[model samples]
Target: MDRKIMSLGKSSLVVSLPKEWMQLNDVKKGETVSFNIQRDRSLVIYPSSIKKSEEKEIIINVTSNEEEILITQKILGAFLNGYTGIILTSDNIFTVPQTKAIRNMAGRLYMRVMEADAKKVYLQSLTDESKASLEQAIKRMHLISRSMCEGAFTALKNNDVALAKSTFSLDDDVDHFAFFIVRILRNAAQNPYLANELHIDPLDCMDHQMLVSRMEHASDYAADITRHIIMLSGANQTIPGEVIELMITAGTQVADLYVKSVEAFFSKDVDAAVGIMKCRNKLEKLDIEMTSKAFIGPQKEAELVCGICSIRDNIKRISHCTFSIAEIAVNRAFKII
Candidate 1:
């Protein structure tokens, strides 16, 4: 192959590819190729001409006598491994124990089953529910988070223990909404038509499912902080009002960052995702400051310090989860960036 030396800069050298080699590969000017660095620091390049792997159809067989719990695990496992279909059969007519068990389990898990014959059943994936359900769930999650933040801040500002306790209870709603999202996505992944209708790729849908999971965990953190706030307000004790205000401000900032990050993910906005990363960095700095001031001693100081540490840790974890979601959005919007 012909090669020509080229200058990259005053301190660097480069080489040009052979024209004949490019032509033989049917590569035109400006075509892109894949490149990688090996462990030995050698560079390897391949023409971007490889084809995608073909999707496979997988089938699972289950018998009527099989325990329902076992069948449920198998179904979930097969779906996760990219199975396209499943078949259930029995030597005799399906018994009430088996049918009833499967039906109960399917309803609980949001899966669908079709009886193809006396001894055979077909299983399909789940999907997102009607638009009303989706919209309502999203709204509830937002409202719960907003209320929790408001209650926590107001309680801290006014030293209202009752309000703080009430805020902690709101975490139940956040957790419920998160579980609902997971159930919907799990169902969608099982049914081909529903998955397609929702525009969710079975594999890619896992990321969205995880985002919801992390948000729930973040809410748990928020609730934990509020609980501590309640404790401090009672027993005639308090953190410096200014410190409490700072913690509240940090928590609110993190919540806003998480919401924007979720929006960026849904909209595939790389710029917004990057903005979230910046906000997370700022939150981290504030956490460090809160931790330092939380440790000054009295009889209750240790408990208060530990509680502040836990709150900061949870908030930082939430930020990290938000960043993970943002990373997915960035990858989608700019594949090579």
Candidate 2:
């Protein structure tokens, strides 16, 4: 709602607050309200008493026939909708799979299972939304995903099955961050006060939401690369050294580009972001050259060749994700510029 500006004195100007808002907050003529000047120079007025809002609560009724995947989605849906208290109820008792699914999803969402009985389970989120840092959380998310790419390539380079196995667990960490970031962004999108506290506008929230999704996807490809690596690096099955070295070098280059993209995003460096887009040219050329020579030398076994190609494809997919990230970085930098 718009308020008419009134001259208070020679230099001061004032605007009256809406009566409806004042009444809702129980503000009287003498009581003071608080306000914050947002980054865009807009003011957000709120009650001075600063009463905490009650956490949103949701209930999920679990039937014996409920699909585990559906249960997981229900919990995540509640979380994204800004619910902090989730209760799962069953008519009888939860099956082992049902209980396990709830526990796993609760852990992933940074929630604690506060209580569980034969017929019901209660989960509460651990983090205080008002105090969480969106930037730090996104940074942590990017760190894990970027590390996953590097780790996957390194695992392939060294033929370390143990290291390759870590991609699974690392991907889970990335997922946690993704979920956390999305939830925060969703909250910020709906609450202007929260957005000001988080130092993000609606546009920033949209960009972050998109970027987190890309990071999650890139991490998935990175994990896929590791799975192929594990398969090809088996004792009885080895891809040629020439093939491995080529894949490693190119994959590592992709990881480097991924790093540059995220750095450009953080720094708001338009030049660096544009440069990342150009660097992909060389990587793509290498992909072409490598594909041509993939069957040459000792790199010609049917199974090994297929596995090498799959790994290469996953690496290329990651590069695509990086390119999208750089594009977003360029746009974000322009917003500041």
Candidate 3:
């Protein structure tokens, strides 16, 4: 059942809970509980004597001389799957080749080699990359995504099929950017010393590569939404201006989330990521509300609604993909802390 809390004074407040909750928890007039003030300004109450689970130790071993691609895959997979600690070891001192790749990967995973020996190197994960390449790549992705959104909006607003067609061609640019990221990763993985000389690690480079891939997919989704908009407009001979505006607005929100999420990922900003996720929910709600509005005729309404629905679904999926990338960033930040 729903409950309400109200402020009573400067320092005191009262909360009314369902009688059922009171009985289920065995609460009495004199009972006490713990309270927490959430970021959203809501108060949470809990039993004071709740039990907590003990933290468990986890260890993973990585051997030196492992292929860079294979090593990165292993480390990232382990990190995502919840390994608490990782230990890299070699029979002798870490060679230049092994050390460079390992350091690169460590940077990407937000992990550090806490202890090292001829036989073992213990790592503590952390998310901190104050590098130009990473920053630039994120910025470019935002710019490109925003541009695509703007182009799509223009096409939809003016019912310009030519402009809409142009938006599909823009996907080529995004693909080019993705290829650039792949090339960077390939080079870094192949020559660890070059990465070391540049003061970056192969693993860190790989993380940036993954970020690029996600952004590229975001671009693809945006393009597909634009293509659908074009098809709908072309097929119907005309689309309601309001419907077009609604789609443009939704597309803009998607772009905003894409940009903000990428910024949060690079900066390790959890609040920013959370904000983007909330905004995505708002966009989804807007799509639903707009879809419910009726059009002039049955045939027109059906076509427009179907097309808008497809665009809406794609936009939501794009927002979700951005959120997923943000989640990875948040997880990386936690490992560091």
Question: Which candidate achieves the best lDDT against the true structure?
Answer: 2
Tell me the tens digit of each residue's lDDT in model 2 across 1-337: 7889999889999999999998888999998888888778878887878534357899889998888999999999999878989999997789999999999999889899999997899999877777988889888988899889999998888888899998757999999888888998998888777888788999999998988988999999999988877776673577667667778888988899999998888898999999989988899888987787777764356667778788889989999999999999989987861
True-vs-predicted CA distance for residue 273, candidate 3, Å? 1.6
RMSD of each: 12.7, 2.5, 18.1
Query: Model 2 reaches what TM-score against the true structure?
Result: 0.90
Ten residues in a row with the worst lDDT in model 3?
Answer: 49-58
Colliding residue pairs in candidate 1: 125-190, 125-191, 126-187, 126-188, 127-187, 127-188
Residue 222's lDDT within candidate 1 is: 67
TM-score of each predicted structure versus truth: 0.57, 0.90, 0.53
Query: Arrange candidates by lDDT, highest first: which order?
Result: 2, 1, 3
Error of 2 at 293 (Å): 3.2
lDDT, model 2: 0.86
Q: Considering TM-score, where higher is better, how would the candidates rank from best to worst?
A: 2, 1, 3
Off by over 4 Å in 1: 1-136, 297-300, 334-337
Q: What's the true lDDT of residue 167 in model 1?
A: 89
